[model samples]
Target: METNLNNQISEEWTVSEDAIGQRIDQYLSHKFPEQSRATIQQWIKQGYVKIDGNDTKSKFLLKGFEKIHVELVLQDRTEHLPQEMPLDICYEDEHLLILNKPVGLVVHPGSGNPDNTLLNGLLAYSSEQKKLVRAGIVHRLDKDTSGLMVVAKDGETQQRLIDLLKEHDIKREYVAIVRGQLSHTGHVDQPIGRHPTQRVRMAVHHKGKPAITHYQPLRVFKHFSLMKLNLETGRTHQIRVHMHHLGHPLVGDPLYGNPNRIAADVVSELKDLVRAFPRQALHARQLEFIHPITQQPISIKIGLPEDMEQLLEDIEYYDDLDTFDDQMDVEYVE
Candidate 1:
């Protein structure tokens, strides 16, 4: 648990002879009162704290004075606290805004991702511009899905975008890198709903929502394939489920893809890069729509994030997935 200063991790400390027979979490509490005892215990249970370079539960008892280490991951505590995170903004106006959301940036606040979302950053940006948005977020992108996304600044704009989306006036096109070499063109017209047995994942449920994805092979890599995707109807996990149903899983999709499939050499030295490759490799490259107020056509394009860029650069590293169908296997572990 040695922390590297250059990496902004505080140097870890060890328990001294003066502290012995103290509970692991209790000792941590005594040292870091700024961090709550319960929070420390929770982090320990989440494997944030390591005992002798091994994972330990929060209640793991301490025998005696030991060279124990503590590594604390930062989490936001204040309500509506704004962080100045760098944003790749592509377009902005009085009623709407657009940006190239980098991979790993969650769109909205959720269970664990309350702070540091694109929403939080937008809120901060709007505050200075004398604007606010309590609602009006037209659509969402999964935390790991990078690319272009639009946010409505006001209620009227939001409603207009929603209507446009319903009427298929807003065209959202995505470029994805999947694990297999696909055909020149294909469409996955599958009904997607909550996976019957695996409630956490969406699948091609018999009584699912109508979902269709039109895909065209853009570039064929050795072991990977870049495909252009168009959504006929947007549902939860539409592209992911449709592609998976059609036997193509996005490269880094943690929930759907092979857990052990990523190349180790690409991110061998970067632990965060390896772990950060947890989300699906999907990016909304293009967003086109007619302006609600001006009625003018608006289009925006975003480039790949650093990780995706690097991943694409290393495509030739692996041999082409020639027997992709024969070797491809789908296990329903949802």
Candidate 2:
């Protein structure tokens, strides 16, 4: 057996004949004394552990001579610092707090992003929030996506909410501006997993986890559409990937959108708005779920953000011009 400790954090190890057949997480627990089995399992689940250059589950049985690589960010859990940041509180109670998370605020601390996250903000928002792991974050939105999220104030409520999410009882709805017009409702029932080549991105793969996204056209423009979407199965970047699969990527999505492919003949005003747009044109518009502790139904709705609202106006203006052109063409033919 060969053991290589890269630094105080991260390491590589070759599975030994004696350690063969043991669960990967269990093996790591005995190898790394500083971390617990649960922490090791979490690292595996989060794709921090790789066996023979591939991500595997915690229960994977090690084969002798297999190479294992692990990123050791779990050692830095204490580095998260509480900071006083503005939190848009939509609803709050002793059991939970529903917040409208602003764009650009990371939900939790991780490698390269060590401080000033929403988790830190929640820690400072209330002392009781500190008691819950990850500030009771039951779900997450991308750092650039602005919208609603619920934070549990206690352990019991946190677990309850987590279970509710697993059961798919929590309803989450989003609004987005896509690059092309969509005439009717559509659903993308595809699977999503890590991109095989681009490690940082996600892609649709047959072997990946199931992801279902249902979208309807709320308003259509000549070159853009306002859409409302609901998720039946949550996967990372599910909406963005599904929309891209449908060939109507979100207007401002830097990852999945092809900005260069935007129609060349678009009105200058609408084009300018698209160029000025900085982030993805996606927002969590509504959320409905049962209160974990109170055992009552709850719902919340919010309108588009300032940037999205402005972009919608530009789309409408361009659409009006197209309508006028169509009418003129019809009259000229007569």
Candidate 3:
């Protein structure tokens, strides 16, 4: 039997005689087959599950005819109202969706942004998503960074995709223009965490989560370099912080970049143009992973956004005026 109370969905079941001596977690797993065993065990640990109205552990042995109860606390979905907005979907199927998120579009609602976010648009696109947590959003890109993102259509697939991300099965690649002349492939293996004093920014700290960013220069300009990057771990602001830590912050990065990094020899107009660029010159260009439900591989790639294309064109035009020299190429050493 099931019932709803306040914001919780309560369910109860009587253990059958055939199930006697089974672990509580095992029994509950049979009852809620859609949920993972870890999730069921977490519920037991959190005191959401009870046996005959008494809190119990997941290891408790279930006796015949014992009443098992589960209370699932629902997330606050009412706070987000659906709003119609255009979505740049790259691929879509019954199980998931891949979309190109534009710059300045907030992924979800937060302190100041309560609506008009991608989550609201997703709900408007498919009312079914309102039932899934965060509208099935498993990953995110910064508001100022444009890129590809995958959104699950169901809870089971959502959990699977999350597990894949944690296991580093998903591959995400990006292209960026950074303020330096990189002549070789390099990588930054660092720890990233919230800044000690700056609450809004992330920093490379010793006590932070492990993060690795591998980068190769696609084109080295006179002062700036266009690079292709891959992330081995996705910590918040991982790429931005790692690049900044390398003294090569992404061009036009508002938070971690220093405008003074521009070389003085650069022409005045080009310097102003680089400084006036609005957002970070980073774009997620490729995404590859195995479909969680279909067991097939999926790969999607997108061209550079218009702004980035134009920025690269401008840099090329200015760079042609300077004498060309072959930069020595070096490999990144751990």
lDDT of each residue in 1-334, candidate 3, tens digit only: 3646544668887888999899999888767644557778988999999899999998999779998888887554335899999999999999899999999999999988889999999999997687677888999999889989999887778889999999999999999989878767979999999999999999999999999999997878778888889998999988899999998999999889976568888888889889889999999989999999899999999989989998888898886426555554622111
RMSD of each: 20.1, 12.3, 4.7
Off by over 4 Å in 3: 1-22, 25-59, 63-78, 320-334
- Residues 59-152 of candidate 1: C-alpha lDDT, one tens digit per residue: 6767764556565645433246556678777898887888887867877787898888877776667553222333336688887788888877
Runs of candidate 2 with Cα error greater than 4 angstroms are 1-79, 321-334
> What's the lDDT for all of these models?
0.70, 0.81, 0.86
What TM-score does model 1 achieve against the real structure? 0.65
Candidate with the greatest lDDT versus the true structure: 3
For model 1, which pairs clash? Answer: 222-320
lDDT of 3: 0.86
- TM-scores of all predicted structures: 0.65, 0.73, 0.83
| Cand. 1 Cα-lDDT | 0.70
